[model samples]
Target: MKLFFQNKLYILAGILGLATSCEKEFFPQPPSAKVAKETTKLEASFTATPPLSLSDAYWKTADYLNIPLTDLSKNELYSDGFLNMTGTFKGLSSFNKGEDPKVMMKAAYDKTRVYIYIEWTDSDFSPEFAASIFNGPNDPLKPDTFRRWTSQGNSDKVALAFDIANASSATGTFDVVGCAASCHQNKMQTATGSVDIWNWDLALSDPLGFARDMMTDGTKGLHDDEGDNLASQNKIIQGNSRSAPIFEWDGTQQSYKRPDGKITLLDPGFYLLNKTPYIGDLDKGDKIYHDADYGCNHCHGEFGGGVGTIGEATAFASTGFAGKYSRASIKSYSASELHPGLSYWQKVPAANQDDLIAYIKGLGSIPGYYLKDPTGSSANIWSVSNVVRGRINTGSVHTNYKVILVRDLTTGNADDVQFLSPKGKSFPFGVALMDHDGKNHIGSLKHLLTFKL
Candidate 1:
């Protein structure tokens, strides 16, 4: 009887162990599985409605269609239906590692227009003001008097990128990673594909014009040359050279002078020659022209005489008069009101006199043109029509921006991506914001956008 009782105890222990093993094998769970489930649960859809108008009244209605955009950092969703997205930017080229402030976004659309409203906190507002042309003797070392280039000293801006072609069908990558898939270095070249970019530069196209419509494809190709290199190649294209000096009227001298207090001269370039002429007080006395404070001769003159090649002469004429005796003639003519028998000014044909006058007249009146072509080109694979407005609350350190962008469902351009499809179709997009100082901006991350009528 003792042996039989021991056998029964052993059998019961074996049975218990087997049951525990089965439970462990069948009910295995991993942390990654839990995360996947949470992500799937939050992959929600958004709907867009037509607004009565594309004004402030229409944006007010967005309060009703609020959808929560989860803040990936905190793993929390804002209670209100605002997509509160955050990121940090780091790249040796543009920025250092810095936290991007929270950005809230809401969007609405009409039959002809799409309106997106964004609000964020900013402490300063930097507009594209005129650069200080007055470079005195102490200008180079004086930090206060130094001026940054427009490209370097610009206003805040925002950009929106859209994957309209759904080109990720093959890789199934953009569907998952969105804009990041296309943003890699050397990955966005024309050979790869193109993405639509709607860039809103505050100083360039704030109240009157539309966003700069741009497209990113491969880095190699003719478009890149036209967009990047051709501007400085001394190529005499229609829009190749577009800078003119800023001049002010000198009431005492009864003439127009540059901000640096020198007589302004005509720019013989294409754009300036066609424009109107400066019509300030005519100098009955003498016209004193000063060499450009910053010019090619200032740097290159050490090797050769102060003279530059004809191309350089054309390019840097605004820096100073260009010719063998151009500098001396400019000064002597200003004092005597007579040409100094110089080959450069004497070569001006009678037929071109009106153009010279027109060029001079437009001086100080025409504003600087920084954008190559604000209207965009079909070759660039992008186009946009937009209206934007903004209000800044200094005390709150926040600025609200409203943008209305209009485009066709299908632009019918080969470079452009077609968005005319079923209502449930989805696309990937991203937004970047620059603060008032224009120093910092959000970088990385793309959001999902679904179409609903």
Candidate 2:
């Protein structure tokens, strides 16, 4: 979907695909948080697949929407759209035969677009239909600052800043774009995607695009129906090549209309364009570093498979659902004895993940560090997992993937460092406090090498 914030357009369309499948490696697995923290360890199991069609009426609870409603329970909020759909898959008793529902939602802000997809096994779900979330009486997404919307029946138009990939010091800022969702129940109606071809003429410091004129009024809303939409931009289509445009970093002198109809342009730091060497290339080192990597089947277990509008869909209806994958869950790995809890990382923060993010973003390429995967290397997956972990910890936990330093603080030299998994399994690894050139840097974890299995 695309939106015209202030007169500048933002394109938000991204591929909704499965994550990189993993190989069963000798890599040590971590134990669950419950087992180590003395909390009750729960066991869970469930089935998931795409719903047969638009009217499969998935009755189970699923919360793909990230916004928490003030009045409704989690389940109630999830099922709200389901409650609105009137049809059901007539002959299908169950979606057990591998059919999954594919739900995709795409939204854009000023310069970026965000797409989320999920697959489940119910007919009640609607890709369209943006309702007011619990926080805002008439807005579908609340704590409404991060997002805005325009609706057309089963389809609710949206403009959102999917902040998941902001890697700079202005990490909170969003790459804005536009998108639309049609009612999934009504398969008869087709929902297409679009992009805004305008430049960022506002500030990038605020996440909501509030300081900019594009979002001040609802005029930033662009559509496929709009004759001169950015969707026609050949450069945008050739830039990213997956699902959306890869805008260029704002450095050139470009002027755009503000929401109030004023003319303005932004500085170099305001926007980033994807002018990588591999333009129009899909399945490159960068394609996997996207939000749509988690498709419907990959998330909500036992539900239909569909791209989500935003956020991850409910893999398990109950908290128990996650219990089934306890070994793979974040809580399991972060609190495990082998990985050392949050406290341990705080005592000696080795790696500066923020610096790492800067380093990665500095490369101006997706999957910047681990560029290729010819050996089907786990490095890119590992980097993504590590980066995600660092974001969650907000600079607390450190591990082999995120380790910054393993050298003696006194000597500040390369040293034999030891690493542990969540299960307390020892792994052979080396750490050092070094600078960009691998020279010793004061109080930082710089060099890391691993040979452990």
Candidate 3:
């Protein structure tokens, strides 16, 4: 069955571009926000012959196995290996509801690395705004700003989660239910234990570079457990930092406001924070940081009344002093408040750089820090490329991406799960895709990966 899929991919590679007309209707669409009652399982066996290169030619190799991801809820699974994984993704927030976008995926791997390919249908190719480009919907001249909680102004993203020890032994619900088990009103906050996350964001982590290495330990707190804090908060600051007064729609005019004179609108869009200065006296108050409610706590979790560390203090202040009503005025501040000297809010502090570098080096002795460029360096173990030809749906403009990640089977890093030996070991994993618009995502299905000679 796997060989059939591999052969089909190669055979269709040539005519795949020409078959777009019929490809749109090739897969069945699942209903919106429909959860699967039964668990979906996918298995991948090891192959001695891996792809010779991480390029189009290598992907055509017969050694690479193929699997079709169809509507799991509808039981549309097939064994022919055709690339037919397509379905709509439901919106996570109430503001954007009933949105169901479709996506497809393929995967392969070698002894030292794993490869994944994903393609989703989207009408727009939204990239994260350049530092100079304004991202706010309200003002064209203003600097770019966007919400931290949502992907409104940012680039598209894809994430994969691995359950290290296996579902039965997992400390959290991730092994049994996948990501949905961790998601809650507080943004995927779980009770205990951690899940390894490989998140690829076009803007935050360039395609060719490393995916944002992150982990979420279903902790109840906001500060420690949240994934991708920098990107999320940057969006929040931009979404709230608007030139004109923010307004909300009352199903009529976009002029609704809270009794305390705060903007009631949920999706304020993106704006550049550094471009917008504090209008009032710094000591007295700033409307953008103080008066507005940017919903930073939705993802940041909670940091009690300014912790001792600079990062903790920033998180505390930016989250309106742990969601207190009195601190609502501080919500308008820019992302700079989170990292004073950094051009980007997410940049790691210079003091912490060495520790981070040492940590990455410890991870399989990879040689360089995860943030460093791999080109012309001994740390060039990962190879990534955007797969453009496999896009099938003409109804929308979309993109496909492939990532080749190499690492030692065993990495001594405490946070990292060591593959050790693959002969009898099985690793459980899941995937999520964020569409081009940055509005919706399809996530939370589990797969078991094994390597065999």
State the lDDT of candidate 1 residue by residue for 382-437, as single tens digits: 21222222222223433344444444456556544456663566566766565432
Model 3, poorest ten-residue lDDT window?
361-370
State the C-alpha lDDT per candidate: 0.35, 0.19, 0.36
- Least accurate stretch of 10 residues (summed lDDT) in model 2? 377-386
lDDT, residue 311, candidate 3:
35
Off by over 4 Å in 1: 1-56, 63-101, 129-152, 166-172, 186-191, 219-398, 436-440
Model 2: runs farther than 4 Å from truth? 1-223, 230-247, 267-453
Tens-digit per-residue lDDT, 1-453, candidate 3: 999998788668636744765443444356565222221333233545554235544344323322223221221221111111112232332111223333434445567655554444444443332211111122222232351111123345666676543322232465566654444443544456555666665544432344555555544322211222223222223333222211111112112231122332211111111112112222121111221242222232222223332233333322111111111132223234653423322343434333322221111111000112222212222335352211112235443445444444655544445667666666677676654323245554666555544
Error of 2 at 358 (Å): 15
Per-candidate total of colliding backbone pairs: 14, 72, 31
Candidate 2: tens digits of C-alpha lDDT, residues 25-97: 3223576332212111111111143221222222122222122101100111112211121111111121112
Please give the lDDT score at residue 276 for candidate 3: 22
What's the lDDT of the predicted structure labeled candidate 2? 0.19
Total clashes for model 1: 14
Clashes of 3: 31
What C-alpha lDDT, on a 0 to 100 scale, does residue 357 get in candidate 3? 22
